[model samples]
Target: MNSPTAPRRDDRPQDDRTAHRTILLRGGDVHSPADPFATAMVVERGQVAWVGSEGAADAFADGVEEVVDLQGALVTPAFTDAHVHTTSTGLTLTGLDLTGARTREEAIAEVRAHAAAHPADPVLLGHGWDAARWPDDRPPTRAELDGATGGRPLYLSRVDVHSAVVTTALLDLVPGVADRPGYAPDAPLTRDAHHAVRAAAYAAVTPEQRTRAQRAALRHAVSLGIGSVHECAGPEISGEDDFTALLRLAREEPGPRVVGYWAEQVAGARDAEKIRALGAVGAAGDLFVDGALGSHTACLHEPYADRDHTGTAYLDAAAVASHVAACTEAGLQAGFHAIGDAAVTAVVDGVRAAAEKTGLARVRAARHRVEHAEMLTPETIAAFAELGLTASVQPAFDALWGGDDGMYAQRLGTERARTLNPYAALLRTGVPLAFGSDSPVTPLDPWGTVRAAAFHRTPAHRVSVRAGFTAHTRGGWRAVGRDDAGVLVPGAPADYAVWRTDSLVVQAPDDRVARWSTDPRSGTPGLPDLTPGADLPVCLRTVVDGRTVFVRPDE
Candidate 1:
């Protein structure tokens, strides 16, 4: 171990730009992400006034109204979940949860119990039922669900929102479902059938219930130190009224900010303008060029190891190129959901063609992105780097469905499964990567997501703690087309979180030593000690724009 080092002293807080009021946070190790050693910060007029040592707090405290002692806790930028399904996630949080039901019988019993508990309800809505881990590897049949619910309407979504199991009641409301694609009597509905059933289910939700659900999900986000989220909405995924209502609620209420995306494929600039009219950031999001790996809807170049089908690809190179060109011409970001290699290739080819037709600079400036670019080839990685595409990825996907014997392996086989979600290669290729939970599919566990990326299943694919944290924080800001914020630097937005942690030390690139600790004499510091089984930091306070969005009672 090395000796402790003296802390850094950057430029003192410039009082010229200071607001009439100021806040001084003192006595803690701050992982500014940009600055290696920042113990304290001064917040002035909704921005960071100064970031330096605790000793220099007196210099910036002349006009300070408040001085918060972090008491040796960790302070970092607030997190942003770049992708989410607000209403659906909230429903899961507040409603019936069958995600834990292990067997077919247990799943049906839970549904019966929930319907019994909420007998006054006209419809039963629940999500998360995975049969992969079950010994029988099957969900309860419609007949069984019908018996359990006693003829009530039921809509249970599979773990991935790509599929759902609708009771006969819902099936009745959604006519022509059996004739539609992806309809199955015993299995969950997918594609067209799932869409129709989902729409009918949403129709059953009252406006009051919808508003309550949205509010619940936003409150949960801020409580966990999340400052903002990009709601991935679409016509096929969610109704316009719901998306607009969410945007309105976010503005009217004091909660985590919601950035909206329409997630529907648009052809012309006129259509893109219509999306903008709906208050969407762009006509992009879960604009599914493909689907998810779990549901086996992700379009692959090769057939699945378990099944003979190679999965579905909704868009070809020309279609992708057309969308990108239109979005670029309209000066909007273009994003698509692509999980498998074939889908990824089509997206890249489309981007490349659009770049050639328009300009590379135009495409790059548009900040085009692809969600769940999981199964990428080296060529696709290089293309993303060349085009400056943002990858809105979910690390929890790998954590929940990856590894040698996990769902990925079960779907694709061990050899191909281990290669899924190669984050290291993307970052190394200079492709800007933004980490998100893709909630409703995964819970909003930011720390767990970071740990999963840092401790990836394949050692060769794993990123360091610093890299993972950066992708989650700063990278998220970049995804939203901001060159600022998501860092504890002077003049940045005062959006940050205080965490109850064991010790505050950043990770250094030094590998010569076996152990990692601060060296005050050498001025060396490190990131959090986020090794395996380490306790993830608990949020004590979360501040957005210098306002207290969430706070724990002083202990």
Candidate 2:
């Protein structure tokens, strides 16, 4: 590693920016591929200057302006969440959250309390209530919600965000929503009706509220050691105004970097230009090819075990091909929200067609993404690798609902559930895997996400801790076409986090490999112990571009 030499006294400026651009952090374990046993690192001008042992660090101790004693902490690359809904996540942070409610009664009680507390609010919005977790598997009815809110307008989204239940007052805001597809007089709304009501509810949020929510979400992410987040904004998800506002907020603030994606289909250069004008990196993310499985709306080849229907299909293969071709031609990334088997099949066939229509090299070079590719087949997984599609997945999905009795099994039967989120298969086939939390649907817990993948409910899908960590960090950067960021190495972006952790150990999907690599002679770096039920590492500090973004309180 090359160390930065000190400038002469005459060349060194008195200005803080010039003098303090270099910082040396020593006396800690640095997780870096550059040096597996790295003990110290130097950051200069928002980039990693060098990484070496403690003795080597002494050579340039006086050259840097600031010296930090890491005091045995573990330093690793800050995480990048590949899929996120910024404003909505913020709203959940500031508004009502029903993630902890176990039964229908508990969810109703929480809603009533929130409505009573915020009496003056125009529309009460809440998220993360799963009927599948309830004893009777019954969602809160519209009548029950009406009584809970005392006729106040309310919209409560299911855990998946694919469907929601609303009070009649909120329903009144969307004209003819009752006649929309997937609408029922009693149960939670799905498909078109769910989208209509969700839009109406979010429209009621004031500009100030929206800003507060966005700030809260970003702040929460940075505090958890997340350095960057990809905002998956779209027309049906959150309007153009909301998406642009979030990008502006992230730019003006000193928080995690926000890479925006407008999930809109493109026809040609004009559409791509419009997306770029909105400050988006791609015209991709959450462009719904199908809804989520929890709502029984994920497009499947066969009928769901519980439901007689095969679920919803928002976009067909032809439409997906057209979108992919347009994006490839325009040099913009095209992606979709596909979860079910049929939806995954459509994405594979469509991208294959696009690669044939547009030059395969160009299509592959774009590195387009697929969000929540949960139910992938071996064929589709192979196609993803062939087409160079990045799987921006949330491992927390499996943690929350992937066991024998979890929601996946309930919806798709135990046999099909085992096939969901085949990370091992995808990785083995050379498909790029980018991990995310899909916050608001699942909380932004980076370490938890890594652990979930490392200790997947299905043993066949689990990956090593190191691989999982890389998927959460560097893989996200690669998805955004950035090869130099998201790692601790010379000339790479100085985005990292300091953690208070237990003894580091090499953990793998197989116990034998983990045991064999524990010796220092193995040259394998270690991460915090992530055995099931073990306490996760705590973020002591998070830095982005050589600037500290979060410092744990009372540390």
How many clashing pairs per prediction, in order? Answer: 14, 0
User: What do the candidate models score in CA lDDT, each in turn?
Assistant: 0.83, 0.89
For residues 382-437, write the lDDT of model 2, one tens digit per residue.
89999989999999999999999999999999999999999888889999899998
TM-score to true structure, per model: 0.94, 0.96
Q: Per-residue CA lDDT of candidate 1, range 1-555, in tens?
A: 100110111111223332324888988877764455778888887788888887777887668888889888778898888889999989999998777888888898899999999988878999989888778988778888899999989999999889888789989998788999888877878888888999999888888999999999998998888987889999988899999999888876667768788987778878988878998877778998988777888999999988899888878999999999988888777889999999999999999999999899888888888998999888899999999889999998888888887999999999999888999899889998888988888998888888888878777777867778888887887787876777888887787888898865545454311245565443544556677788888889887667677887664
TM-score of 1: 0.94
* Candidate 1 lDDT: 0.83
Please name the candidate that would achieve the greatest lDDT relative to the true structure. Answer: 2
Which segments of model 2 are wrong by more than 4 Å?
Answer: 1-20, 508-517
**Candidate 1 positional error at 66, Å:** 1.1
The candidate maximizing TM-score is 2
Alpha carbon RMSD to native, model 1? 6.1
Candidate 2, residue 175: Cα displacement in angstroms equals 0.9
